[model samples]
Target: MSFSFLPTTNSTTTTTTSTVRMLPTRRSESHSPASRCKSAGHSSSSLSNGFIHSIPTSAASSTQRVNHRQGSLDQLIFKLLTGKPKCLAKVLGGSGVLNTSKNSVAIQTTPIVERDVVSSLQNCSEVRYGANSKPRITNITFSTVTSATGLPTVPAEPNKARSSSYWKTEASHSQSSNNNDTHGTSVDLLRKLSVSRKESGSHVDTVVTTIDGQRYDTKELDSDPDFQEVAEWAFPIFQISRKYPKTVLSRLTYNIFQQAELFRIFKVSPLKFFNFFHSLEKGYWEIPYHNRIHAADVLHGCYYLSVHPVRPQFGVAKSPDSLLPAPQTPAASIMSQMSTLELMALFTAAAMHDYDHPGRTNAFLVQVEDKKAILYNDRSVLENHHAAESWKLLCRTENHFIENLDPAEMKRFRYLVLEYILATDLKQHFEIIMTFNDRIPDMDLQVESDRLLVGKLLIKMADINSPTKPYGLHRQWTDRICEEFYEQGDDERKRGLTITPYMDRGDAQVAKLQDSFIAHVVSPLAQAMNESGLLPILPGLENSELWINMNHNHRKWKEEIESTYEPTTTCNGGSVNGVIEEESASTSDSPDPRRDSPSLDSELSQ
Candidate 1:
């Protein structure tokens, strides 16, 4: 995937056979909108964060409107890709192929090789900033040219038939061959090539020459020792889903790739992100129930389940000879029969189980009596809403990421995506486990082969277990969740609504309640998940265990806060504990918390 940066003074649209030739804008001009596009590329992936899976063509086309408003974002991407600050600025200020005002558009007329030569020369401009105080524009416009319309795509190597391993070995051989001959030059060229490959959708075998007169082949570069880490992280996910349809995975990957591109478009201004935030809030944003990462995880898990010596009571891959239907054969396969679509759905569902979570607990939504609560009649409001919203977002005809899918298969996809995401809600945790117990009537059968019922449970298991990922990652999740909670709490306080105790930071006693809640609820759930072998690779197991071990750690932290400010301890124990205990006592024959002064934290400590 070699990338070339092109520069030209032309900015006119010309017509050609079966396509339009859109000429470049002033490549040497400063204050160009292209400059804006450069900076926008930085956070493209993070911008699309919170979704399960996004289909490429559909997601991109659907978000074209969103992209238009974020024109400056494209400039940033252009800058990043080309490394031309001045040329980037000129492109952004309505001077590039991005003249949306023109009724007509132009396509590339030059051959790909010539374009590469030009693009490379223009790329040299990226390294310099003149004495003039012109702000570099990073944003630029992108116009897609279909191959069928005669536009050239990234060129592929004609006779490169070597396997991936062969290429790696070749790169290694080359690296040691010349200590300084071309190794360092090759490294830099390879980085640009990789980025270009990403942009042009080219194969890894592609080659691009850098300005430093160094030639680098991506295939050879990929064979390096350092590159192995990336391959290791990617291969497991790819191998798991390798059996699935190429289009599904391809589109999924492309969508994620574009999302990273789009993130750069809007991340420059916090104000720009606000529009993005509002768009998301107003419903343009949907975290897909089956997103990319989740799809990868579920597919990976499916592989583990498929090949595991030990099996759960019920789940997918019931048996090798179960005569389960094929996934693509959607109409023929009954819901009971496992198929590729189901597998994809399962994987997709797992990936998008918690797409775009606003991060508050279900209890917070219920206590605040949010509209979501009313919509769901206060029953699993957050869970129900997430599932509903994710589906609604996917239903748009434009966002039909699941292309080439039959109507019947599409319907099934929707159901599976919904069912799986809804099942991920914490409210259904206990019931899901119980269902697992019931579905697997025989212990022997449970361990004999992987059951579809058990696999479903495992899918849900992975979704909830996400927070248990790793200490640093898990803490990051916690922070996001806290941010969401605080946002909700702020809204509640502004509305003069009765806010959930710990949700509202303004409450003097909130810290103590939070500490206690962490002890009893968060820590315990994390521990249970770690012990269950479901999330064997969760982030902070060791650190969390240490935190759990110290009975006085949370208390001491709370006491430190209490020393500065005091408030009436509404419930002698933490509020969450008191509420849970009271609710439990009233609903069952259990003893009341008033009679048992032992705090939930104390109980947990024991």
Candidate 2:
């Protein structure tokens, strides 16, 4: 079969009609006639009686010209069927339409046509025609044949034509089969087109085709060689960062953006997204903790929780003492019910929830009458400041990543972001947990409002997930946070203010403090999440790793404490009993050394 475009003119206007001609197949020199007949099938024999139908095209401007070109049958079929020039460009594997005038309509081929044309059109006829034969009359329409791209191929002969009902039935089945395939192909094509355009140094707007063949303009996908490398780094971001120290931040951001397919969904500019992330990264204080690294960790946690099955990871088992039944819902199911906007809000909130933190508690900021404390009436000072500062940075001209959002959408996004961020405040921790416990037992995620509440709870969980990590990582974070706390205590002491309990370098028992935190805060929340069916009881959360490690460290602290209490005896006598007697005598005459000096400072500071 061969196809050509014909330009026809009337006195009033001109039009171009595409004509397809089925020709007789002659046996190839390389193949015997029997082999040719078998390969070509009855379609070759039926082509002798096939007819050509003239379908009028919409009128084009006078300057329009029909460019007749010979190419692959796939290209011809795609060009004849797909109306969009962008689809044609993608299928043809070109950056764009080639050499065309203002009035010319480019017919580009897409990858979707590759398999469709080969399967459907190639086997369309069942009989062969002579090289020279007069055209015969046939009531067949191109619409039925064209629809075959989305339908099962029909075998046809000179005297047989299927009914429209049969064509319709096959078309429905074909559409269902090709839906996912077409969508995947479109995305691949768009990515390739994006890469090709960048390589060619073209600054033209990129036209991306969707699964249903709808086209929209998008910025070119990042063509950096590391883009793919970043996209494949899924989770445990801290480990990935440690492994790739230099590129972790960039990789993390790119991976999240690509995995969510946010670039395509939001039609965001790649440069703008990167600029926003860089600015947000810079906004974090270079403190021992509560910095960009923590933000990244939280973002990774949020992403994993959002995409993975939460039930198996945090659900209660069917034990006799279990408070809640095993969770029937999967985290992925809840996540699937969330809108793209909601997911974006959750991610953005996780990354910026602690922006510009000064490594001081809210109480310290309020007690010191810090400017930020006064700015928000000393209520959730750090949380309020983080939300405000992050939003302000996002609105800056260079970092307006969501500039394309409609006004209402932007407003909703801002509200969700601030809500999630504010929910991260430690002061609000109990209240959030209470709310989660109250709702989770009978919560139906099918309700949109319930899903939103769950999303908020997820961000909160992510904010404090450090304790749920592996023992080594958890220890590392504990050390970093303790250092930050100690620094704050040092600052407070230097200013003649009382040091907070956990922050006091001279008096704090790091292990005891962590043990208390795990028992009173982390464990309760984790238990609630699992028992309430909000999260599954995965090994990470329930296998006693964190508690065992914390207890081990606590025992070491107790040992050190006991060692500090050992009597400071002098060698007053050669015998051990005489030394104890002398030490008792010294202890009676002098102030207790243990009371005078604190051992926790030296041990914990180490």
Best by TM-score: 2
Candidate 2 regions off by >4 Å? 1-247, 312-334, 536-606
Clash number for candidate 1: 85
Q: Please write out the lDDT profile of model 1 over residues 392-448, one tens digit for every residue.
A: 554543333453343434554566666666666555555555555454434322121
Error of 2 at 115 (Å): 35
Off by over 4 Å in 1: 1-339, 354-371, 406-408, 437-467, 507-606
lDDT tens readout by residue for model 2, 1-606:
222233333345454443223332221111122211211212211213342323334322356423334233233333434532222222232222221222222222212212333344434443224344433222111123333123322233232222112112111111223233423444354346534533211123354332223233333234534334331212355665566543345346656766666654454655556667766876778788888888887887677666554552232334787777655744343345465666788888888888888887777788899999899998888889999988888887766778656444566577778878988776666666778667654566544455666787778677767656654567778788888888988998999997766577776556555544544455555555655555533343442232333333434444554565444522221121111111111111211123211343233235
**Clash counts for all predictions:** 85, 25
Q: TM-score of every model?
A: 0.38, 0.56
Residue 68 alpha-carbon offset, candidate 2, angstroms: 9.2
TM-score of 2: 0.56
